[model samples]
Target: MNRENAPSTLAADYARAVDDRQFSAMETLMWPEFTQQGPGFSAESRTVFIANLAVLRSFDSTFHLLGQVAGEWQGDQYRGETYCVASHFFQRDGRSLCMDMGIRYQDVIEVRGGEARYLSRDLNVVWQDEREITAPILG
Candidate 1:
C-alpha cells in the first residue's frame, strides 16, 4: 500500500473486521495501547475495546459502511472519519426486534514501520430506532 493511503486502507480493513466479527484480525490492526471514546463509553486499552466488541457480537448485529471521508495527514499521524449503519436483530417474547443506528467514527491513526495502527477513535451516534419486525430465518 502507498504510504499516503495506508490510513484509509486500515480504516476500511477495520470496518470489515468489525462487520465480520473477526476479532483476531482486528487485534492485529490495533496498537496495544489503543483507546476509544464514544457517546457513553470509553476504552482505555485495546483489551477493553476488544472485549466490548465480543459483547456486541453476541447481539447478532450487522454493520454497514455508509461512507468514509478521506484521511488527512497531521504531522506524523492521519485523521479520518467513517459513517456507518448498524442493525441488531433479536427475538423477545416470540417477537422479533430490530434496532438500527447511524454512527460516525473519528479516528487518529499512526503509521510505524509501514503498518498503520489505530491510536485513538471517537464514536458518535447520530440517530437510532428500534422496531418490531418479522423474524428473519437464521442460518
Candidate 2:
C-alpha cells in the first residue's frame, strides 16, 4: 500500500475490528502505547482499551460506517480525522432500539516500513439519534 493510503486503511480496519468485536486484531493494528479517548471513556494503553471494549457486548450488534477520511504525514506520524456514523442496536425495556452516533475520530498513526499502526485515537461525537427499530435486524 502507498504511504498516503495507510491512514485511511488503518481507520477503516480499526472500525471493522470494533464492529466485529475482534480484540485480537487490535494488537496488530495499534501500538502498545495506544490510547483512546472518547465521550465518557478513556484508555491509556491498548490493553486497557481492549478490556474496556467489553461494554460493547451489552449491545446486540453494532455497525460503524466510515465517511470522510483525510490526513497527512507529519514527520514519522500521520494525523487525521475520520468521520463515521456508528449504529448500536439492542433491546431495552422489551423494545428494540437503535442508537446512531455521528462521530469524528481524531487519529495519530505511526508509519513504519510503509505500514501503519494507531498511536492514539480521540473520538468526538458530533450528534446522536436514538429511536425504536420497528424492522427486524436479521430478517
Candidate 3:
C-alpha cells in the first residue's frame, strides 16, 4: 500500500480492535511513544492504553449502541477524529447500570509499513460525568 493510504489502514485496524475487544491486538496499534492527553484523560504510552482493559472488562463487557464511522477526515499529517458510541454497563454496588454517550475519539496516528498506528488518542466523552450522585433509578 502506498504511504498515503497507510493512515486509513491504521484507522480500520483500530476499528476492528475496538469491535472485537482484542486488547492485545489493540496494543500493537499504537506507537510506543504515544502520549495521550485531554480534558479528562492523560494516558501516555501504549501500555497504559492496553493494560486498562483488564480492569474495564471486570466491570463492563458489552459494547452497546455502536454505530457507523460517524465522521472521518484527515489533515496534513495522519491525524483525524472518529465519533463512535458504545453503551457500556458500569458496575456499582454489585449492580449493572448502562451508560450511553456520543464519544468523539480524537486520535493522533501514523502509518508505517502499510499499517496505521495510533500515536495518541483522547476518548472525548462528549456526555456524562462520573456517576457520583447520578444513581440509577430502579425499583
> Which candidate has the highest TM-score of all?
2
Ranking by lDDT: 2, 1, 3
Q: In angstroms, give how far residue 97 of model 3 lies from its true place.
A: 2.5
When superposed on Cα atoms, how far off is each prediction in RMSD?
2.0, 1.4, 5.7
Q: Candidates' TM-scores?
A: 0.85, 0.93, 0.65
- Any runs in candidate 3 off by more than 4 Å, and if so which? 1-20, 38-40, 64-76, 90-96, 129-139
Q: Write the per-residue lDDT of candidate 1 for residues 11-103, one digit (tens) a residue.
A: 778877777888778678889899999877889988999888877766656666657666688866888887777777777778878888888
- Candidate 2, residues 18-55, lDDT tens digits: the string is 89999789998899999999999999999999999999
The sequence of per-residue lDDT tens digits that candidate 3 reaches over residues 1-139 is: 4555555555666666655678788767787877767555566777776776564565444453433333233543466666666555667876557666677767676655655577777777787533423435679
Residue pairs in clash, model 3: 10-116
Which of candidates 1 and 3 is the stronger one according to TM-score?
A: 1
